[model samples]
Target: MELYNWMVEPFQTGFQIRALLGGLLAAVMSSFVGVWLVLRGMSFFGDAFVHGVVPGIAAAVLFEFSPFLGAALAALVMVSLLELIHRTTSLKEDSAIGLLFVGMMALGVVLISRSDSFQGSLTAILFGDALGVSWADVQMQLLFVIGVGLMSLMLYRPLMSLSFSPDKSQALGMRPQLTHWLLLLMIAAAVIGSFQAVGTLLVLGLLIGPAAAAALITRTVPRMILTSLILGMISVTVGLIFSYHLGTAAGASMALVAILGFFLILTIRETVAAIVRRKRSTTLVEQGAS
Candidate 1:
């Protein structure tokens, strides 16, 4: 009974329910896009892209405009700059990512510093206020979730081919470049839709952690995605419950849970594999002795 109450208590209020809905929506979209990011080895690019949108979101906060538009425009600029640097310079993609990562984050701080409520606004933008989620926010996130899901499904073959062999994708007429751009767009959408719930800095946790954890035990992409969705939801639920009981920041709690969950899954998987190896070795020795 106490355990049941503990599970039910955090979501007793309207704001709490909204927070759960928002987090779930964020998880759904992030999971759909995140699997591909992991497969394509673009985790660094995804991190930079998340930070890349901060200036736009900060500007929107200061100028009283829609954050979604600001984030979208910033995403376009980030990708364009990344592509230009790759095409025009001898520097590697990682180098370009590092440059934009620092530059965009610093720019965001500078922009946020201009606000009258600089500290408050910055905190909210960086850490998020999970309890402050509104129904309107939930509605917007739902649309993003649907769009991401559809795109992910549509581009699965191209993305899979690109991940394994870009040359093969090109040979197959998959248009690897266009598929790559669409994946970037999906990542941006997930980050933009989720930042309000988990913040841009922390949204990467949900974006990567769940999918990474799922990768540990799952071999197939479909199973990995399903496992990631389950893990993401668990992280959100457990994080919120802990936040309510322990007086923690909801978004930070959730992000932390997602990351910790990854390590836990890793530990368990490794331990199980070791035990199995040991058992097999022991059995072989016994058979040899006999």
Candidate 2:
């Protein structure tokens, strides 16, 4: 009907199909990684990575290379720098993260202003408009998502162990150091994959919102991850539809809606629990009176 036509019309050409697929893939990949980021108390790091990638992404754009790879490498460099600073000095993780992120982001802005395609390149990289996606974009997202997914799946043991307790994991011969870097690499990959759909700015919604919401509603890591994926997809689909119809920013709308959905779920759960508690109290009162 009308809705079907709207959806199909945009995708009648291959370009739109790629855009759609890229977005969907980003949702899946980001949601999974977001869970870990939320659980590890490293939410800010993801945001930092988003900001920190500006210079690398800008450089890659100028060199006509893969901007996503450039962005990932840049983030890894920042992580390494943070680790070095933390180890070499008394600086806390938060302090280190703040210093590196701000410095790199400022440098990026300066470099970006010099590049002719800076605005356009950054717009696409930071907030995938979905309107500008090509087949190549879709292919890149697919490959990254699949590669990262398989990698994470295989390393689940070490990652989970490390997340629980690096000391314990290391004591148990798990190579916590190796696992730590691998987890960061996974996060970098997640952020890179989401660069086109959610953009670097809003992609954290995938890396944080879904996971936080899932955590609020679940007790186990696996359950949280599954819930995060579902919530992330819901955010993506709803945001896309609203953006398409209302002429709003798709990535922003999606992030807002996803966050709203988290609160909505919380409200509903609270209300239901309250009602159940009231009923239980009333039943107890009646029984005691009898």
Candidate 3:
């Protein structure tokens, strides 16, 4: 009975229920978009996209506007700016990403430094307030996840091609530039939708961690995405449980769990590979000696 209560007590509250739902939606949404970022080697872009929205969100808070709108608008501008700078200047993609990421984050700090409202909300913005998530927030998360999933289904083949081979995709008339922009838009949408659940600073953890873990174990794109989604869900659930029992921050806990999952998988994969190599060497040596 005590064990049952321990398992079921945290979920008896409305806020906890809402937080769980929000986390689940965030998990699903991040998995779909994150797998592509991992395959494209654009995890840095995803991180930049996450931080790039901070200024917009801070401005929105100051002016009493929608954080999601501000984040989306800012993210689009950042993506366009990255493309523009990369195209016109001698700067590389990583250089542009670093410049924009640090500049925007610093700008956000400056903007927030002037406003008391931002000061109060700063922790929530950076690490999230999962306990404060409302049912409306969950609904929004659900809609975004569904929309992202539909887009992934519709654009799977082209997006996959673009991730695996952009030059070949362009040669096949897939319009690599347009697909690239679309991916940027997808990343922006994901970040905006997720900021409330995991915050901007930790959003990259949810976005990259599960997909990276799945990549080590899966050979195909679809399987990788599915496995990432499952792993993400597990992370959310386990993190929520830990947060409830230990009174830890829910968003950070979730992100940390996802990252831990990635490292755990990586370690297991490396160990397995090493064991296989050792066994193969031993077998060859024995055969030669015999």
Candidate 4:
């Protein structure tokens, strides 16, 4: 009975329910797009992409426009600049990413600082207000989930081929370049859709944590994606429960849970593997003695 009440207590209010729904939607979309980011070794790109949209979101907040549009435009600008630098300069992609990451993040701070409610707006954008999620936010996130999920499914083969071999993907007429752009768009969408729920900085936890954890436990992409979704949902639920009982910030709690889950699974996996190796070595020594 105590356990049941502990689980049910968080959802006793309307705002809490909305928060859960928004988080779940964010998780779904992040998992769908995050797997590709991990597979392509674009974790750095993912980090930069999230930060890249901050200026747009900050501008939207200051100018009284839709954040989604601002984020989308910012995403486009970031990608375009990245590509331009890559094509026009001798610097590596990482350099471009680093440049934009710092530039955009700094610009966002500058823009937000100009706001009348500077501290409040900055805090909300960076850390999020999970319990303050609205039904409209949930609705928008649902659309993102559906769009990202379907696009991920559609681009699976192309993305897989590209991850393993861009040359082969291109030779196979898979259009690796187009697929790469689409993946970027998906990542941007995931980040934009989720930032309101988890905040821009913390959203990276959901975007990479579950997928990275799943990669350790699952072999195939499909299995990894499935595992990531399950783990992501579990993190959200556990985080919300902890937030309710401990009076912690819900979004931070959820993001922290996702990140901690990855380390916990990694530790357990390594421990078990070590134990297995020790047992195998013992067996080999016994056989030699016999």
Compare the candidates by TM-score and give the number of the best one: 1
| TM-score, ranked from best to worst | 1, 4, 3, 2
Candidate 3 error regions (>4 Å): 1-6
Model 1, position 102, has a per-residue lDDT of 93
RMSD of each: 0.7, 2.2, 1.5, 0.9
Taken over the whole model, the C-alpha lDDT of each candidate is 0.93, 0.80, 0.88, 0.92
Runs in model 4 deviating more than 4 A are: none
Model 3, 1-290: lDDT tens digits are 99888877878878888888888888898999999999999998888888899888888887889998988878877887888998899988899999999998888777777788666677777888788888888888888888888888877878988987989998888888888877777788778888898888888888999999999999999999999999999998888888999999999999999999999999999999999999999999999999
The weakest ten consecutive residues by lDDT in model 1 span 120-129
Q: Could you arrange the candidates by lDDT from highest to lowest?
A: 1, 4, 3, 2
- TM-score of model 3 vs. true structure: 0.95
Candidate 3: what lDDT?
Answer: 0.88
Shift of residue 233 alpha carbon in model 2, Å: 1.6
Clashing pairs in model 4?
none
Model 1 ranges off by over 4 Å = none
Predicted candidate 1 versus true structure: per-residue lDDT over 87-191, tens digit per residue: 999999999999999999899999999999999889888888889999999999999999999999999899989998999999999999999989988998999
TM-score of 4: 0.98
Candidate 3 C-alpha error for residue 271, in Å = 1.5
RMSD of 1: 0.7
Better of 2 and 3 by lDDT: 3
Model 4 Cα shift for residue 115 (angstroms): 0.7
User: Per-residue lDDT of 22-117 in model 4, one digit per residue for the tens?
Assistant: 888888888998888888999999999989999999999999999999999999999999999999999998999999999999999999999999
